[model samples]
Target: MFITLVTLLEEVKDILKLHGQMLNTLLKNDSMPIMAIPDGVVFPLANVEDVIAMNEKCSDPEFMSAVVAMVGDIGGSSLEDATRRMMKFLMVPELQRHNELAATFNTHSQSCAIKHRQQDTLEVLDLSYNLLEENPALLGGLEKLSTLILDFNNYNSHVKFPYMPSLTALWLNKNKISNLPIIVEEICSKFPNIRFLSMMNNEAAPSYFNGGSLTQYVDYREYVISQIPSLEVLDDTEVQEKERELARKTYRMQRIREGSRKRKELHR
Candidate 1:
């Protein structure tokens, strides 16, 4: 019994050493929080000072137990650059747990700057209020992305949307785009899965500004619904339920016919 107790104690000591090493790594990077929770608990000591203070004040046994339980309930985590003072405070771990991590580059950056590339796991990305003209290629790879908020980013011109199979919501408001019918059409052509869309506040060319009208925009929006005949909403509002259903079905049949015709011509 004595030997068994000694062995267990040594194992516990080694585990504490490992946890200490992990805390040290997080402290040195300054990006992650230095955590000091006891075994079987997770406490994200994020950059928010007030939250830290609250946790410290409530460090009693009961409070610690409750806080540790609440740790896994974090909303989300943010990644920010260490150099920018204003942005450094935006690093909240709650955001990461809730799956809302926004990535923004400083105005001083001449090129489009992206800090994180955990594409397979990321869900929401907000790159608003920047000046990235080239349509950064990093987003093209995030297949699991549900929402993309790029409002106020100065693109100076319209940019293409690459094929994202799982994209449902898109926000590209407050840009200098004069025409985006082709861009929209490409999205409808490639990513027929999108349901929520907001291109408001963009100065689309008068000739291409067609919201309800059929002839103003490019044929891409029509093309998308034809492929994914179950799309329920556009620009966040659900369209006329019955009317849109009929229209989508009709559009799908038209696309099938057109596709078949083109294939026949190629064979000929």
Candidate 2:
């Protein structure tokens, strides 16, 4: 019995270590090859070999979802150009094998048929941290998209997000936007199902300023909450119950200590 218990503990430790190593491998930057969508669904212009390997590995139907790179701005041109190329690549049927995909950063890929109301199967798309300069016009193409994550893109121009009737989650954070586009209001009015919306840190600092003022930050926060009614999560700002309980406990402790000290002084 003692020997069995010791062996079980060792086995559990080995399993945990194996799980940690697998997680590290999955998150490693060099593990997966980086590629662009217009170039290919799996690989951009440079990493065709990686794309092939990804396709072979991901072809297994057991895996529910797989991530792929959409487009990377090699030229760093206007958002319109980036989106155009992205759309061109998405047209390929081979790329859309998985209904769910976590895309690489800054893929402005659009669907022409969806734009024209021909076909629709796109369910999930995550394009975060691309520093997008324009809102892609192709958002209208995603008829079945339930979750759309377009966070950390700095767009100077007004890009519209319309025609996604099934959208639930939309993430728009860390942009250079000073004004919330009117189209966003229209989206709220049109789509009553939207549950999660985030538009945080859109304020641009003044040319000479070292830090943003409290007033400026609050104003932006208030504006976003007020604008989106269906929003469940706002600006990634959530107060955990644990933190609140801890604060309450700390306050009670301080009060008790103060009261004890006062009583001792009175006795003295």
Candidate 3:
């Protein structure tokens, strides 16, 4: 029993020593560069002071958790403070290599210069639930981005999207989009590879769904499909083969009628 107690006491001492070493490393004011640490390593410390201290010691962090930790709870913070803190982290060179980014609920506008060093490597970006005054040029550099979620923003009819060749899926639900024709024209011209698009709950969508009729919904879907030939999924519904054929026929007939009217005007 005495031997067992001695061994247990030694084990406890060793454990305490190891913990002390870890604490020293975390609390140390040494000038160790952050890039020396392996990519994607999480700092186990809590609080903004420790995080900022570590950030100063490290040249770059794998994730923005430390920067976000500085902001505390996002819900309780003001929009300006949240946006400022998030932008500080986003400007980091190491964080730019990350494929996915979520900056939701921050009131950021087009004036915010959200640029990254490795823009081409980014794939998925979510900027939902923000007060975006206009579509920012931050997306202009992200050529390889495929999935972009910008739901519940301040986008209106005059807003224009940057040309993104690799973009496939886009979510613009609950935005202030009103002019369907102009936006559709811009999308058709700019996003040629876009296959999935959602604009549900926008101003233009409800106008088409007057009285909530299924036929009106179909009409809205068909018109959007006609405008954007590359679209396969629209507003969470898949465009069927029959609908595609019908849309094509409708588009061709409309073009023929417009051509006839133009010719008549020219002759007059």
The top-ranked prediction according to lDDT is 3
In the range 1-268, model 3's lDDT, one tens digit per residue, is 1121112222222333334422333332223322222344343333434434545434444233343333222211333333433333323533322233223222232213133224658787765545665556568778798988877677887777889889999888878887888888878877899999999888677534334467667767778999888888998779898999998898789999999999999999
Clashes (N, CA, C under 3 Å) per candidate: 13, 3, 2
The lDDT values for all models are: 0.48, 0.46, 0.58
Question: Model 1 over residues 20-106: C-alpha lDDT tens digits?
Answer: 422323234434442344554333335345434544545465654443333322212211111121123223446333322223222
Residue 188 displacement in candidate 3 (angstroms): 1.3
Off by over 4 Å in 3: 1-118, 207-212
Best by TM-score: 3
* TM-score (C-alpha, index-matched) for candidate 2: 0.42
Per residue, candidate 2 scores C-alpha lDDT tens digits across 1-268 of 1121112222222332334422322332323433323222333212334444545544453320222221231111333333334333433434333232213222322331123223367776644444555556667656788877666566642555565669887766656655554535655765568777665555432111325676665444444444554555545664244433554565567679999999999999
Deviation from native of the Cα of residue 241 in model 2, angstroms: 16
Comparing candidate 2 with candidate 3, which one achieves the higher lDDT?
3
